[model samples]
Target: MADPTRAARPPGPARSALHRLRGVARRATDHPRVAALTCRLAPRSVRTRTTLAACASVAVVLLVASAAVVLLVRANLERSAEADAREQAEVVARLATEGRLNALLPLDHGTDFVQVVDAGGRVVAASQNLAGRPAPTRDGDSAHDLLRGGDHQSVTTITAATPTGPVTVHVGASMRTADAAEDVTTAALAVLGGVLVPTVGALTWRATGRALRPVEAIRAEVAAIGDRDLHRRVPDPRSDDEIARLAGTMNAMLARLEAAGTRQRRFIADASHELRSPLAVLRTQLEVALAHPDPRVRSDLVAGALEDTERLQALAADLLLLARLDSAGRTRPQEPVDLAELVRHTATARGVQPHPVTVHAPAAATVAGNPLWLGRLLTNLLDNAQRHARTAVTVRLDTEPASGAAVLEVTNDGVPIEPDDREKIFERFARLDDARSRDDGGAGLGLPIARDIATLHGGTLTVVDTPGATTFRLRLPATPTPPAGG
Candidate 1:
């Protein structure tokens, strides 16, 4: 028994067939050999791939459109033939209703073949061409096909009420003209599509090549550039397109690489020179101490040698710090540091200096950073201030009102740094004639290290202009202070 609650559903044969086809395709793609074959057959060149894709798309569209046109033209021609046949059939039916249809029907030889049959299915009247032939019978009133003289005919039938009884009228029109027209249309479209598809593919190939020409030139130029010739740049098309932007971007990258290479070479040379000075001094002191026999003289020479060794060690340490700072990917643990407290503690730990160091931190200015590096930054700033100050070095810690960033300023009452030399002072191993000297026990890396630390904490350190004094300002993003006792 059928379940009354179940809804009627269609058995979707087309959907099931599509699902099966998809499964077959998936399995074929999954097969290792088939996948390998597909990969091997795939075109590697962008131009070839684009051309083939364009051709395939055009082919599919043309094929579908051609098929639709043929179908539509055939349908229209068949409808026209059927309509003519129906009109002829109605004319015969009207003659039969008036009892005027003759046993031998008149044939115009252009309209259609006509015949009349009685209710007993006997052909009583017919056109002169179909006089001896029997009329065809079908179940419906729609147009149908009949074979005559090796050609198909579109036949339409109708019924008419006569004075004696009900009779049937049949009319037929030849389908040769419609068939010939449909065949010609299909052949023409096929030829046109064949020509058009190849033309489209050729045009696509040319366009793709032209578009990628700049990219190819860039690749060749970059390939030709050697490590020593970083100054050479790729050609720019100067157009406002992606290729032009790519060329510009690549040129900019080359510029950066060239600058970095220059800096690297200079750094190596400077490092070598700086190392040689202390090494030569130490060697000289060691030779003097070894040659002398007097105990006091030997002791003094040994002390001098030891001092040079200390200077070499300090320089080596600074170089190592700079190397670590240059590594962009290195990460350090961080914690919130109170800028005011750090400034005070760093100054106090430095002990006494030639100049009086004053701290003017009145409030808590908190920032997130590695405390060790932050301390070193502050210590370096204080040392620089003391080294250059005439009377006093002032350290001020406060937050910027507008951005709420913690700002630390170290000021010294020294000869103001020249506007031009201000930025140069922060360069590694940079020295000015008045400020930096070999005898001052100062490796010019102190300020640079301080700046690197500030930058590592997402902050900046720079020298700000001040009257009759030099000021080094440090700015860091501020962190919220914790609630009391929390």
Candidate 2:
């Protein structure tokens, strides 16, 4: 027995054909070569497309309007011609009633075909245009009537009462006249379109090109700017328009870029100088040890080399930390950190023996931050204070209930930083020391890194001036305490 569970197979031919067609369509749409060819065949420039579209739109509108006018004029002309013919026929019928039909027969114009039929259905009188034609209508059958004899022959007929009896009148103007009028209208419209469309297209092309000229100039200027020459700016027309605004905005951006480039170059030069000194000293010490044969001098040289190596390592670590801080989307786990305890710990680490450092925190001030980075920030602050202090360093932690922030202030009895130099202290590789020596100032990145860390933790580090003291103040958003009952 055949297996009843077997599923029936679908038909192959129609499905296969559809699948092949779909595959072809996908290839045509998705393939790069196909897309490139399509682009090549299409209008590539905005000017070309705009001109063509404008011309086509005008052409379509003119065509539809001209068609409507031609139809209305043709209808009116046909109506007028037919009405005139009928009126002439009525005149002929009246003449026939007066018994002067023979005089009016064989009319002069020959444009209208007129015939008069008697009550007995006999062709009694006719115009020259219908010389041998039979009666176009039956006896007494003419009342706004159209009579067609051949494919192209037609007449408008009407019946009127004479003195003897009623007679039929046949009248028709040729179709050629109406056709000729429409033909002339169409020919004239064609000629107008031929002239007008090209003119519209040419004007559109020129207008679009003129409008985009400013943008083209901006693009060229931007393209010509090199890494070494970010100071160059695009030309501004100074008009109160979009293009002018765009140029102004671009120039502002270039100015900012140039400033940033200047800072970067300065930082690199400073870093190179800092690194070169240690490296040169280390190399020279090694070379001196090689030249000398004394054991004590070799030992001193090794020690000096180790010190230089440690300084290099410290500088490298600081650079890496800065790099990480600058990277996007880098975050660390946050927890409540006691600012008072951190300040005391950093002050102790920096040695309170020599400088007589003191701390005052009446209440616990807590902030949400990474403990490691917070510790680094405290260490940097304490180090800076100890380095600049003349007598003692004082660490103070307090909470501002109004702003809900924890404030840590490290004050030293050092010379007050100048008003202009205070802001410059936070810039990378900036040193207020006139010598610009790394040995005395420690790579000049400590304050910048400390400020960056404080900012990352939603805080700020700034130098606050007291009467005779230089104080570095750090402010961090305070973590709120929970309800007592809860």
Q: Which number leads on lDDT? A: 1
Q: What lDDT does the true structure give each of the candidates?
A: 0.85, 0.81
Candidate 1 C-alpha lDDT tens digits along 1-486? 886544354358866988899999999989999989989998999889999999999999999999999999999998888888787888888988998978987754434577788888788898877778765656743324442545678777799999989998777788888999999999999899989999999999999999999999999999999999999999999699999999999999999999999989988888899999889989998998899899899999999988888899988988988887778444633598887898988888777768788899966877888888899899889988998888999988887798889888999998899999989988877888985578763878899999998888888899999999999999998775679999
- TM agreement with the true structure for every prediction: 0.86, 0.66
Candidate 2 minimal-lDDT segment of 10 residues = 143-152
What is the C-alpha lDDT profile of model 2 across 1-486, one tens digit per residue? 765544354368877998999999998899999888988999988888999999999999999989998999888877777777766777787787787777237542423567788888777777765566655343554432434343233366677787778888777666677778889998999899999999999999999998889999999999999998898999897578999999999999999999989988888898898899999999999999889999999999999999999999998998888888877244633698877787777676767655778999855677888888889888787777777888998988888879879888989998888889888999987888742765556788899999989888878899987878889999898775779998
Q: In candidate 2, which residue ranges exceed 4 Å CA deviation?
A: 1-37, 68-181, 283-305, 329-371, 391-410, 434-440, 454-461, 473-486
Overall local distance difference test of candidate 1 = 0.85
